[model samples]
Target chain A: MKAIIVDDERLARTELQRLLAPFKDIQVVDEAVNADDAIEKISKHQPDLIFLDIQMPGKTGFDLLEELDNVPYVIFTTAYDEYALKAFEVNALDYLLKPIEPARLESAVNRVLEKSKKEDTPELKSGKLKADDQVFVKDGERCWFVKLEDVRLLESEGNYVRLFFHDHKPLILRTLNYLDERLDPKTFFRANRKHIINLKWVENIEPWLNGGLLVKLKGGQKVEISRRQSIKFKDILSL
Target chain B: MIFSVTSVVVFTTRLLTAQDFSVGMIFANMVNISTVILLWSAIYFFIHYFENLKRSEIERLVWEAAVKDFELKTLKSQLNPHFMFNAMNSIRALIEENPERAKTALTQLSNIFRYSLRIERTETVPLEDEVKTVEDYLALEKIRYEERLNYNVEIDPAVKSIEIPPMMIQTLVENGIKHGISKYPKGGELRLKAVSVNGHAEIVISNTGSFSEEEMKNSKGFGLDNTKQRLNLLYGSKSEFNIVNDNGFVNVILKIPPGGRQNESYNS
Candidate 1:
């Protein structure tokens, strides 16, 4: 993972860079001292991650995030205690306390790697799509501003995902596995290898062939949850 | 041989050699006058003592209330300085880590400082306002703690209009981070939920970590005892505060009763 350490303190920046040198997974791309400098470097390097300090000369770490068109995976580096970070941690960001411990930094970087590995899509900062999340979908000639809750089903076809909503089925270039990464599991279920269905749209469920379960959606679309997934379905939704 | 009305009493007593008819009548009149004087004096003193006792009772009640206000204010004073001190440390770290991030934290730090300065030493502020301040605080801390911390906040629509003590919830959260999450190598989450129950606003904060009996007794961890004191001062028995550790997680729940406070407009 390519990363940058942005802090006003020269010693802290140098110290952290030295500590991070031992970690082989992450490459320290370039360092930026202030928000303006960091912004310029970020746009230039487009580093996959940033080790950010909250307090700086001009703009704060948060202010830098606010100004960004796309935020990288952020692991905060500051002297403040964990209590103060509660609000922003709501976003899928992490932080490392000061006098950065090598082990802690290693674990935090490993988490970023684990997440990227799980998504296989490094561009989407961090976090799952909620019910009313707005996502842009362009299918050849037509485009969409589909609300996540409005879509009832997602079916996989090799590298593409077919979004099935009311009277419209738009195929998007994103992989079904990618959709699985962004969708909340409790609401969006991975029913089978080729399909993930919205639980809210399920009209009925009955026994299917080969001991699987057939789920009838509100729009008359029937999906088969593979036997392996049926067990998970029951576990998640209760018997 | 003749003794007239009042003079008859004195004359009869002096000339007691022979039995006199006027002697008994004069003695009776004198006894009645003296008895009236004694009764009046007794009633006057009794009333004076009772009035003095009543005044002291009232004075004692007022003094007790004033002391409570003072104690609550004292606790409030303690909260901000502690919060400020941590914020300063955060800013200091930012100064070392990234001047840009420190600059960012500086703005938030100052805003909080201004808010604290302007805040009316109120027992409670608008819930929305309190949440905003908490957000700013967390943002600064987010920069400081980085990846070790994670948190979640859920607010009920009904509780948005309610009010709560300025730093009450924040203090508990701070304590949670200080004594619990900060101590752990891999820091954990802090979750805050605000909901309305039976017309009262209930705020529940849970953070990942537990407290030893020693820690709770020695430090009160900047949470338990002062919180209990503040609640009593502001809500008496109408409000409730509880802190419990279930294994590794610590939960602090506060409930504010309805109808105790008059409606105040929500601060933006």
Candidate 2:
């Protein structure tokens, strides 16, 4: 996996690169000294992952994540222990304290590999999805390992998407288009540009104005299905 | 008796009485002039002495008042910046995961700034306003701690209008959360109670945590120390601050005079 290291400290960036040299699959595409430089390199290189530092001069790693429409998998590296809880809250793929251990780095890489393998797997004959298929969301002090099935709807807000699950609605740093590509197309239907409704969670459906449809989910969330996607919705659900 | 010889002489000179009358008038004028000079000297000396004493007393009072104002301003300045740093840190943590909650925290933080900027200009604020500011601070901390923090406030309506130092309760509540509750694994509860007793407004803040003798002795941390200094400056002998530990709980109690309530009501 190609990755970039973003840290203000020169020694920190060098140390992380040295430690990562052992993993042949992980390539150090570039290194950035701050959030702005990291953003530029991330757009240019399109690295599969980024090893981001929490505290920088102007903008923090969290600020970088907030700026992006679609964030690559991130592993946070920070010297301060106070931010460990907050790192977890941001749904970081992994967090490494300063003077990172080799074992920890290996474990994080293994998790990424495992995720890639799951993505590569072929579809099963069974219509029901497994619990292992989940999405991670971090919003400040709260985080959740949400099963894809539990997510009732994805509401778009400008360049971000709000994940509605349980009693919480958390806005993730990914656009609706990015989520559409990642989610399984058969189970998660794009109702419109602004919304994506889970097919299994839909409890009631009715026709609306201009060939559109109104869908009510099991959790009582109602979403408007646009006229453009209603034909596709019918074809998929055969309704 | 002295007039007998003079009367005989005056009778002989009766025909020349006009000259004698003129001499008598001249003597009376001389005595009057001397008396006026003596009275003017005494009056000038008295005015000079009193003016010097009054000038010295006024200077001393002005200097004392200035020093007291400086100390209060310093304390107010320190409290605001400290609180602002913590609140911003909390807001940063909340922004990504719970934007809605973060927004609420930001709003509360704004309220704190509003209160801080105005509080220092006045000697006291209504007990109700002070409690509201404390609640805003606690709400921000609650967002940071998530489900770990809880608080309960019990204040009598009578004392709500009673005025005390602007940040008295806020400082204590902040200490309860920062020094007491945040250190624990499961976090702890903070309770604020206010009551009026014998024309004095008493505020009690209790939190579930214990501080050892060592921590209390150090006492160099800015929050509690500033709170104590501010209390002393504002109320002097009339105010009291006591910290007690009983059954693993730390409690802080403060009391201030109730006369300032009317002054605060008009200002608010």
lDDT of 1 by residue, B1-268 (tens): 1124336545655565356647755765564465556567667878998998999999998898888767556676344454565556556645766789889888988876766765654557777777776677777666655666788888898888787777777777777666555555456778888999999999988888775677677764546777876677677778998878876788888998765444332221
Candidate 1 — which residues are off by over 4 angstroms?
Answer: A1-239, B1-70, B77-86, B89-100, B212-214, B260-268
Model 2 ranges off by over 4 Å: A1-239, B1-69, B77-83, B92-96, B261-268
Instruction: Please tell me the interface RMSD, in Å, for model 2.
Output: 14.0
How many clashes (backbone N, Cα, C below 3 Å) per candidate?
A: 31, 4
TM-score of each: 0.39, 0.41
Give the true-contact fraction for every prediction, in order. 0.00, 0.00
lDDT of 1 by residue, A1-239 (tens): 89998986555677788778888888999999778899999988878889998766457676676555445677888766454366445433577777677799889989988977765453344466665544545444344446678899999988888888767797766788887987877689999989999999999999998889999999899999999998898888785
| Predicted complex 1: CAPRI docking category | incorrect
lDDT of 1 at B211: 57
iRMS of each prediction? 11.2, 14.0
Model 2: native contacts recovered, as a fraction: 0.00
- After best superposition, candidate 2 residue B74: deviation in angstroms? 1.6
Error of 2 at B2 (Å): 72
